[model samples]
Target: MELNQRKGKVMIEQTLEDALSEVYLQISPNILESFPKFRPPVDLYIYDQAVAQVKKFHRAEARLGTEKQAVVATFARENLLFLLRDDYRVYAEHLSRKLGLVLVEDDFKAREVSEIFFIAFRDRMDVFLSQPKIEPFKELLRDVSILAEYLWTDPCRVEFLTKTLHKEYDLSVHSVNTMFIGLGLFVMASGARPERMEVVNLALGLILHDLGMTNVPKFITDKTQYLVWRDRGSIENHINAGLKKLERLEINDPTVRQCMSQHHERLDGSGYPEGLRADSMSMAGRLCAVADSFSAIIGDRPYHSSKVFNEAAGTLIADKGRYEPALTRLLVGLLKEGFPGCVGEDMN
Candidate 1:
């Protein structure tokens, strides 16, 4: 499939170069103009075209090699519609069962997988918050490591990845942005002797910090109205549960533990769990706290829509000693500079 725009009109073409050297108009410029408003069923047209083209070119092939071509022809004819509709995921699973070449999304290419994993981690946060299971949490941690390595090695990939998984959910999007922001701060602050492993650990911890809520019921988690005292208590348990789960994983790294454990802890000894003061918290933990809080304030939640970046920054700064003031200022500055588009009021 290829997309090109000519004379201010977009064209999408599908090409099949097997036994049947087939080419088809998957989408015309007219159809492209209606996208995100009126999505036409061009995938069906592509499927029909593939079938007709294959039959026109390779109906008499009978040998083993030809048999393989027939199989490819059949797959293209039968699955083209599904593939175009983002249903390749379903077909890939079916093909995997038969030990065939499972089709993978181009957006999920090796260079893009890290970003996809990051987005998936955020999407799975609701599950993690509700179920708080061990295995899924571990998987989330693995994704964190993957994304960190990708970001550290190829910073440019982050922009491409972010552009690809453009989700409507604000919280999930905010989580990805926060991970980048936090990691950037870590890299910048560490100066000459940046500990790469520590950065990865911090990323994992920051990404999955909300995993403990999986045990909470939906009524409590999704409550739009003010949560009752009991519901609030249950919600608060997520933080402790997240820490306990991390401990069970035997993550002895203090930076990782503190990032998860003290993200909610305030500098004024008013925070939860231990209520540790400024001296008690690790630098990583303090950074995570600022990142998490700032991200959350500017993110759409079940209770309230997201605030503008300036508004969220002001709120964070107002909290003052409750959070790391300097770090909060740095985060606010980063958001302003790096993601001017993020602070807008529009949900999309």
Candidate 2:
């Protein structure tokens, strides 16, 4: 029975890998080069990052205890790779309501080759985060997953991306840049402790703390006029807008809560609707505030030209009481070093 169980696991692993290899091979370098915005599914990325061998990811999963093992299984079932179907008729009939992914008649699926098609999700999690309570948090995880995939293989690009990010200030672009900046700066701020959870949670919170913006009208976000009292009120309301979005979700993670509620606040009792001071603002909030302002300064806006890395760093430093001093120091040092010359995780 043990042997059979092992064989079953291996079979599932091999079958999934075989399908992915076919997809990867079918999407040749030429094909991939054609789509400049193309990003691999998370499964393929994790597999690639774990080791060249297909067996390694499964082994990592297999080694997990029961609780974590179940989580992996849940992830697999809800993964985008598993959701793509030529017909997906049953899915269209049943799952279209529950899922928020791309679904169409096989012919309409991909704008590219009909023979080889793909479908991903703005929110791919069909089951794992389907609960009313679990769904709000999924966007944070989804964005973080995309950022991780981009970082896991192309660490050099992560360092260089801030320059490009300065030219565009879309919400998603800003969030991605913030995740990388905050993760890197937080490591420098904390003296580079090896505790993985600190960086992970910080990355997630920084990326999604602006979730409330999705509800705010684009006109307000894009306005050319100086923000009046009502406009500022609308902007400040986003903090609670974000909190309300996550209120149904049963998140035990305090970082998520702090980021959702406090990203706009300052240390000098001068920020936003609440006017929270240094004592009230949590460490996560303070660190994220620095990253948020840094990215915003570097990012382009209708009102002002984008600042270079040094100029952006100076803006953060000059705003003394608004941000934590030690974090600002680390951030300045990080900008000077240009992120340790693009240090990266080894595949080994």
List the candidate 2 regions with Cα displacement exceeding 4 Å.
1-166, 339-348
Model 2's alpha-carbon lDDT is 0.53
Quality of model 1 by C-alpha lDDT? 0.53
Candidates in order have lDDT scores of: 0.53, 0.53
Q: What is the C-alpha RMSD of each candidate to the true structure, in Å?
A: 10.5, 13.7
In model 1, the worst 10-residue window by lDDT is: 3-12
Instruction: Please give the clash total of every predicted structure, in order.
Output: 8, 0
Q: For residues 1-348, write the lDDT of model 2, one tens digit per residue.
A: 012222222344666656654433222222212222222222221222123333223221123455644444443433211223332332333322322222222221221211111112222322222332455456545544444443443344344433324246677657766765777666555443324455456666777677777777788888888988887788888888777766745454789778767777899988865889999999998888888888888878777778887888888789878988888887777666655645632211
